[model samples]
Target: MIYRADPARYDAMQYRHSGKSGLKLPVISLGLWQNFGGTRDYPSAMEILGHAFDAGVTHFDLANNYGPPPGSAEELFGQVLARDFRPYRDELIVSTKAGYYMWPGPYGEFGSRKYLTASLDQSLKRMGLDYVDIFYSHRYDPNTPLEETMSALAQAVRSGKALYVGISSYPEQETREAHRILAEMGIGTTIHQPSYSILNRWIEDDKTIDACGELGIGVIAFSPLAQGVLSGKYNQGMAEGTRGADPRGSLRASHIEPRVLAAVDKLGAIARSRGQSMVQLALSWVLRRKEMTSALVGVRTLEQLKDNLGVLNNLELTADEIAAIDEASRDGLMELHPRPSGWLR
Candidate 1:
């Protein structure tokens, strides 16, 4: 069947500029970090991608080591792009990253110029693209000189392998330095990808969010549901096939502590009051900040994608609701009792 994108795709969705860059991304972006890998079902993946694009989710985020086998997610997305989205290519914002153990070699995993340059080439090849919209250093390499990493990213822009460059999971100071280094090289740092959710607030505590806002770098939050913990899925307990139940998954059983579940329950109650699902509430909370340019969601099924998209129906949260959320989060409550509301404070 011929795949034509819905004509109304752009009508309901919202777009925000990536930091000070001219590029604008959808308020909600789809991430191929999981479920689009080799082990997943192909037709199902195609349906999800098609549905997402139809609903105006123009940004699709990927990384070199995203798949369990590495590089498979890009391969999968590449196939879908060719078969379904060839004509609408210009309408999409496709991004990928490198900076993990992509291969077993000394130069395979860091922010070195050699690794970043090579990884971008491999990623472009795997995605069957002339250039990606954004290329990111997946993580900050403590051992690599910051200049070296930013230089590699600058080269990507100069060589036209990527339209923009970004950093993921970098510390506050490193993010500032990266922007400075890239600017000196005549390139603007476009976006910052970080793990942010109701449960994971490290970016806030560490002031990375503040730094991005000050630097004019957009923030796209990954795991805004805290790897599905904020979805109220683990409230009852870890199900058989949930991420927490999978030992190899990033969301471990230990992450869903009793206190955390208690917090989620409180959050769920707030969601119900707002006539929203836990997923919708979680996403809305992440997007509440002006600095949050997008919430990057990874969904396993089309139904889950629909549920996530429903968040757009009620994107705004009242100030009192925000305060309630802060009180309920309990700072993920490491202590036996709840702490003062940091957000309210």
Candidate 2:
């Protein structure tokens, strides 16, 4: 049965401006990155998507290489759009990204003008849409000039294929250059997606958040849950079949170190007192940043989606609470990426 979103949904979900744009996006956005592609549950994906919208999550984030087969997540979401969400397209803030290893050959990926343009076309075809609400360069390619990639994104807006453009995982310096280049083209960046959470705070030193705020660009922190580490799920060790167990899922296994588990246990206890799950605490923690535009989260089930939405209701963290969190999770991300000067891999 086709489900309709609750009309009162907007009453409960918090909204934030997309930088200086007229748009006001939900404080929490959904991203289809890891488990929404091949070998994942499409029905659960649809359920999560539907539940997200019904709970006032209007923004959906995706990328070109977000599937087991790469590009399958967009195709899967396109199927959902065609089957259940065709009429509500205008009500949704859909975004997709390029600039990673998508297709073979030199021209198929990276921040080059040719790759970005072609990738958007392919992404649009996959999503069954003429235009996405926002398109992004996905990453910063050191080899490609900022002007070249920025120009392609600007052209996407002018050509009516993308309403706004953003960048992801860009270093602070590169992001500043990108904003300048896009401004020269008369198109301001609408958003930036960074990895930020209690366990991963790259933006702290990068100053990208302040940069975006100054440039009138929105900031959406992806992996705000630290890829589920902040969820209190790994305290007893990763479940028999979970992110740590899957070869495709393993990226930073040190995330579950003994100290990390102990910290999560303490955080989880505090969350229990607040009558919220650790996931909710993590989500709320990210929302505590006034400079944060949105929290782009990933989910594997409808229950997870529902659990995360509760973050909006009890977001008022006391100053001491914030201090406790800071004290508990000190320098969590620094150890994960010991080499700050090295490229993100």
Candidate 3:
């Protein structure tokens, strides 16, 4: 059967400009970091991608090292793009990144011009795309000069391989430096992808969010649900099929600490009072920031996607609600995991 998208897909969704750029992304963007891998079911992944677009999620985020085996997510997304999203290609904002360890040897990873250029070519080939909407340096490479990294990103735009370029997991100072460097090259740093959640507020402490706002760079928060911890799924304990249970997953079992679960329960109560699910509340909180252009969500099922999208219904939070959340998130409760070294933070 042929797939037809809902004509009213733009009705309920909201869009915000990425930084000062003309590009506008859906407040809730779908991320192919986890579930859309080659190891997952093809039909289910395709269904989720279709439904997300049908509901006004115009942006799909990916990275070179997203899948378990690396590059598999792009391969899977390429298949979906060819089959179902071919007609709506112009309406989508497809972004991918490179910087992590993608393969063996020295040329496989980091911010060197060699690795970034080669990795992006591979990503475009895997996704069967002529040019990605936005390309990103997945992380900051201390060993590589910032000029070298930013130049590679600039070349991507000049060469027409990417419409825009961004950085992810960069610290506050580095975020500012990246923006300045890119500006010197006559390119704007359009967006910054950071790990932010009620349980993980390093962006707040380090002022990366502030830097993005000051630098006119949009922020798209990844892990707004703290690897499913903020979703209230682990309130009882770690379940067998949960992300934490998967050894290959980014969420480790130790991240679900007792204090973290306690904080989640408190936040869950706040969600109940507002007639929102845990997922909705978590997403709403992340979207509350004006600097937050979007919240990147990775879901396993259609139900979870719908629940996440429902955040748009009541995206605003009252002052009292903010206070309650702040109190609940006070102290070291947010420090569930150790801060990663260097730009990985």
Candidate 4:
């Protein structure tokens, strides 16, 4: 079935400028990290994406290794663009990353000029895009010199293959260095994708988000629902058919320890008191940060996507509610969770 977007969906969405850049992102964005893989059933992906655009999600996030087999997510997303959104291409903000394991050999991953350039080309081919709206270095590579990585991103923009470049899961110090080098090369660094949620706050503690405004980089917070740990669905008990059972889902049994469950219970009550579901409350908390430009979320179904978009209806997180969340997490509630690749320095 061909997909279509609902034009009247913007009545409830509020947009924010990405860092200091002129581009604006809706409060919620879609991440193709899970369900949009080529190995998965294509109909499900088209359903969620169609619902997303109809619900006012303009941005789509992708990475080189987002699927069971690497690069399939981009390939699947390309099919989605062709099947459903060809005419609306000018209004979409599609992004893909390339720093993780892609092709397997030495140059297949990391921050070398050869790896990045080849990765972008491969991503473009999979995405069926002449140039991506944004391209990202999926993670930092200490082994490769920073100059070589920055040059690769510069080359992407110079070659008109990527309109903007970004870094993901990088430390505050590395973020500053990359921003500086990209600026010197005259390549624009538009945004940084990082994991941030009520249960995860390392980016806030390290001040990487605050520094983005100073460095011309916007912030996209991924996993804002903390792998569903912050939602009412998990507040009762291990919900059947939840992400916990998914093979690629990152939530470990240790993450569902007694204390974390207790925390979710308390937080869930607070969300109920405000007449919103725990998922909505948790998502709103991430957007509570003025520095965060968008919340990039993953979903297995269209229902989850719509529930997440409902967060746009209430961006009003009161000061007292903020304090309540802090109080609930006071027992070092999931403090300083590492930024994917390794612990933050």
Maximum-TM-score candidate:
3
Residue-level lDDT tens digits of model 1 in 1-345: 788899999998999998888989999999988678988766888899999999999999999988866899999889888888899999999999988878877998878999999999999999899999999988888788999999999999999899999988887888899999988899998999988888888888889999999999999998889889889988877788778878778775556888888899999999999999999999999999999999999988899999999999999999999999999997573211112111100
In what order do the candidates fall by lDDT, top score first? Answer: 3, 1, 2, 4
TM-score of 3: 0.96
**Which candidate, 3 or 4, would have the higher lDDT against the true structure?**
3
Please, what are the lDDT tens digits per residue for candidate 2 over residues 1-345? 886777876778889998898778889999988878886766777788887888888999988888867898999999999988898899999999987787778998778999999999999999999999999988788787788989999999999999988988877778788988888889988888888888887777767778887888888988788778898788766686568767657346678777777778888877888888999888888888877889998887777888888888798888888888888776454343212223231
lDDT per prediction?
Answer: 0.88, 0.83, 0.88, 0.82
Model 4 misplaced stretches (Cα beyond 4 Å): 335-340, 343-345
TM-score of each candidate?
0.95, 0.95, 0.96, 0.94
Residue range 252-334, candidate 3, lDDT tens digits = 55467776677788888999999999999989989999999999999988999999999989999998999999887664245
Q: Where in model 2 is the C-alpha error above 4 Å?
A: 334-345
State the lDDT at 175 in candidate 2.
79
Per the 3 Å backbone cut-off, how many clashing residue pairs does candidate 3 have?
Answer: 0
* C-alpha positional error of residue 124 in candidate 4 after TM-score superposition, expressed in Å: 0.7
Residue 185 local lDDT, model 4: 94
Quote the lDDT for 81 in model 1: 82
Candidate 4 residue 60 Cα shift, in angstroms, is: 0.7
